[model samples]
Target chain A: MNVKVIVRGKAKGAVLCAQKPVNFLGGIDKKTGLVRDEKHDLFGKFIGNKILVFPNGVGSSVGAYTIYSLKYNQSAPLAIVCLKADITTASGCAISDIPLVVAEKKDYESLKNGQEILVDAIEGKIL
Target chain B: MELTKEEESALDGKHGETLALAYRILVAIGEATNADKLIPVEWAHLSGVNYNTIGDAGEEFLSHLSKDAKFRIKTTVNPMGFDSDNVSKFHLDEEFVTKQQSIRNSYVKMGATPSFSCIPYEIFELPKNGTQVSFAESNAAIYANSISALKTNKESAFSALASALTGKSPHSDLRDEENRKPNLTIRMKTEPADEITYGLLGYFAGKEAGSSVAISGTKGLDRRSCKSLCAGMGTSGSCGMFTLGEEEGEKIDFDYKEMARVKDELNTSESGDIITLGSPQLGLEEISDLVAKLKGRSFRKQCMIFCPRAIQGQIRNLGYDKELTRAGGEILYDCCTCLTPLVDKENIDAVVTNSVKGAYYLKTSNGVDVNLKSLHQIVEEETK
Candidate 1:
């Protein structure tokens, strides 16, 4: 299906879908790529090299730096797919060179956690 | 999103890695918001100064970027973790001081003005109305949009920095006048008697109305009260701009009961260890007003008054600094009551403040209780 490309790249991995918006700053461990926020449904799961999916970003703007730190530590996700792209997630992926795309509501809802998918943000498509 | 030749070159890394990165961020944001094109901005005010807020990641990133990046337009910064001049007096940790100093040096190297004041609207002369600027500080963004008639989206730290480097912002969101109208209306049922009440009203309104809001029944708000409203609204949610008038939309009533609920949530302590002021740093006018109010009175507890250093020099010239000092008020420059290490949990259990923004941060970020009160009530009861 067609999607909106934010950062251009190609990535393929299993999906890790978050039901709620994520706050990268305090919500995830920069070094470990683990969801540390106790309130998150994806808590105790590692996001390393996986295709992370969420609605959007919330909380502090410093979440951009956390995304960079995740990359610097080599613990970043392979790619990100969201229903909407907020400044925090968009800018973070842009600077970090991570593949990012905004999928349609039906396309995003159809994908389940642990489902394998390939995201080609350069061509703005999902397969 | 269409890009000019220069923009395309920058995105392709012809200009340099820093500019390329900056252009990349702008392009991403523009695509996400569906902006037609890029527009030039006159000013860019940045946040993410406090070491507590940005941490080691930001410190390292900034230091690396400072090697070649310079601000393309007028730029200003927000407060740091502590007062640079009074570092010895505050007894801060050595590592924190070093990291904070590195962050300061990075911004300086990038050609940003060392304003270090959150209320850049008061300290610096504003550009003409309708001028587009990038302000990352939430309170400053709200004030610029709602009060000064300037145009801006509530920019993020990295996004504003990108604008500073490129002198360009996406022509979207609040920057366009068509999107400036209110989506919701908040009718003040109870009279906003003081700045705290106005603050609560703003907080409640922002939570209900995510973007722009029209507020009726609030009139004649002084600079202090307006600033309180901006700060309160900035604190609660992603809501950025608020207009003071009636509008056609879903209406919410801000009655006395609603005010009491917000106050009850913030006012965790009946008493406090210290009295703190200035969540959005006070201006010369506010400082003068405070001096007049404390003319013959002395505070019974330790009072910390935060203001900009430029105004500090003015207060010194007017000899009001001595009056405040004699009245047991410690004047702190370049830092406010929120997210500051000056009021540590080890030394103090709770703080008394007249700012709703201060109360929220002091409780959540600084790890202390708050005794929320109005400026009038604080002066009447805490002074002798």
Candidate 2:
């Protein structure tokens, strides 16, 4: 089964799931695109070109620029899929030109790490 | 989203690529939030200035935008990486100073007021009640919405910058009258009498409300206490606007149990050698109060206060700067201690502050664990 969500850009990639909220500013490394915070469950994993999934963002208005920085460094995720989109994540994805979609909690909960998911942002669908 | 004729022209590339991009970003955000149209804003306050916070990519983006772009409306900026006048005392490395200056220079070139403090509400003459603004810093946005009665969403740096360039934000959430009313009521059975207590109350309220709320049953809060509460709630919750003494919505008791739990959770420091203040820049009165508290006493640990250059000038003129120096403390400018790298510097193992946002950011942004305490408590423990 598939669900519809608010989509900003269309992209396809494998899923990299994080259960906790992300603070992109210092939480992720700009150079390597790896989650730097030891406390985060996805620690040491590179996020580049994956369909990154998190519950939401936490901390720092600079989180917006970190998204842009990730893209500029060629290390941004192919797309972001959040259960609920906060303003920080929304602005980050909007400015970075990264495909982003906000989905229901049940739909997000159904997603598994490493599963190939299609983010059809133009039509606002996840299949 | 519907765009006015001028906005459509800008979208059509009449206002150069910088503004065209700004307009497009605004349109995209507006659509996402279901905004029906774009509205003009009188002021824009930007965040994401500190080099430590934004790093190289942010520097590149700002420099690129600032090259040909100028702010169409009055704009103010958040703090940068270090104190410009007291760079020598801040222990900032040469590379950090250079990058910080570059960030400052780019914004200055782009026509933003060199107001390198987060507390723009205190520094700038805010627009009248219901006047729309585009503000990025959480604390300032909170103060604007709750205290000043101005309207603004909690904007990100990108949206705020876009609004500054185009002087328009998508009309949604906070702009509408219906969304401003409090849906929940927090009746403070015990008044939040002190600034620090207000901070805790706000932190708790935001956690519980999880949305717009009205605060009641408390004695009238002074400006400082109000700022503290707004900042606290904004940091912990998504809602920025709150009303005090409003007679609406489901009411909850703010009793001793809630206060005790919050105090136990927030007051976590056992030993703090580096005491820091000013999450939002301290007002002149706050500085004066600190001076009176010091009373020529010396400190066992280093006490640091953050403010902008203008406030530092006032501190000097009033002779409090010298008094602070005598008490093993000094006032630094051009950055907020929360956003700067000063907290992570050597020999600083523990930190004490009164701001929920300050403690949260210091841990998240710098990885420095902090304990929340009032200035009075911090002063008593740190000073002789």
Candidate 3:
């Protein structure tokens, strides 16, 4: 079963899961696409061209630009899977044309790093 | 979601690529949030202006957008990466200036006001109560909703940019009065008279509210105090906007016990080398007050006052800039310590500020030591 579609797009990529809330702004390096926050679980991990998964977003309204920056630099994730979708991540996904899915609690728990996933946003499926 | 004819046309690409992209973003966000339709917005206050925060990729994104887009509504930008005049003074390298200035040029090319500040409400002419607009900055959005009575979603910078291009936003949540009615109420034990109390109230209330609408029972909060409270609340979580004073809701009694805990959390044992103010952008009066306090004294370490360029000019005209600089104060413009890498670059071990939001970000996001103090206390400690 897939999560609810927040932004309608289709993508398939390896997973990069973050258990805690992700602060995109100042949290990730735009050029390198690496998570910069030393405190984050996925610190030093590159998010480019993956299916990024996090619980939700936190910090800085400017974080939306970080998402856009990721896309502009060709480092944005292919899709996003979150436990709950907040306005910050939603706006980022919408503007950047990134497929965003808010998963069920069980589905969110089951998601793991490096899991090859296919996101069908129109049909609302994850395979 | 229902879209008006013009909006639909814009979404359909009849109005060109810029409007179409903006429309698409609005529609997508609206659908996700279960918005009924689009509503016209009078203004947009944009964030994502700093280069140190947004970096090279963000500069490219803004450039591309501005190449094809012109704002449909009046829009104001947030602070830039560095104070232009103080780039060398702040010890910013040459490349940093180029990248940061590119961001400013893009937004200015797209017709956004060069008024760089997080507190855009003061720079722009705000609409009457119930006026619909899009604001992305957390503190500014809270201030607009709670104090100015202007309706806005605590929008992200991307959405605010879309609203600027389309002059419309998804009609959801804060746009409607019925939805804004408080679901959680924090009843304070004492009147929140000081800035610290207001900040604590906001911090405590944010946790209590937690994705639910909240209102504070504390009354007679001055504008700065209200702002401080909201800034604290914003740091706790994405609680959106909270109401101050009594309103109908589920009441949560808060007393001195809660205040004590919050106070403890906000402070640190470490001494700070730098005194930075205005994460939410200091007001004109606050700047003046700081100037008056630091009239003759010279600080041992750097004292940085972060504000917009316009206000910096205003202070310079009033001769406060000279007094502040003479007393070892640097009235920096465009960026604050919270949003930029200046603190880390300068190797600032610690920071002391009156801003609860500022302190929270410094600790959590920036990974810097922070000690919270009232403006009066900070002034006393720094000046002497």
Worst 10 residues of 1 chain B by lDDT: B202-211
Fnat by candidate, in order: 0.42, 0.46, 0.65
Summed backbone clashes in each candidate are 0, 0, 0
List lDDT for all candidates, in order. Answer: 0.86, 0.80, 0.79
Per-residue C-alpha lDDT of model 2 across residues B261-374, encoded as one tens digit per residue: 877765656666688888877878888998898777787877788877767677889998888888888677878867678777366766888776677667656667677777
TM-score of 3: 0.90
Question: TM-score, each model?
Answer: 0.91, 0.92, 0.90
Candidate 3 Cα lDDT to native? 0.79
Candidate 2 residue A6 C-alpha distance from true site, Å: 5.9
Q: Pick the candidate with the highest TM-score.
A: 2
Candidate 3, residues A36-66, lDDT tens digits: the string is: 8776799989999999989888667878877
Residue ranges of candidate 3 with Cα displaced over 4 Å:
A13-19, A29-50, A72-75, A104-116, B189-193, B210-212, B217-220, B253-269, B292-298, B364-367
Per-residue lDDT of candidate 1, residues B1-384 (tens digit): 788999999989999999988999999989877788899999999988888777777889899999989999999999888888888988899989999999999999999898888899888888998999999887899999999989998777888999999999998888889888997889888764688988888778766776689988886589988999999887766677999889997888899999999888778999999999898888888878888887679999999999977687789999988998998998888788878888899989999999998987787667799998888788888999
Enumerate residue pairs that collide in model 2.
Answer: none
Task: Give RMSD to native, each candidate.
Answer: 2.7, 2.6, 2.9
Instruction: Give me the displacement of residue A60 in model 1, in angstroms.
Output: 4.0
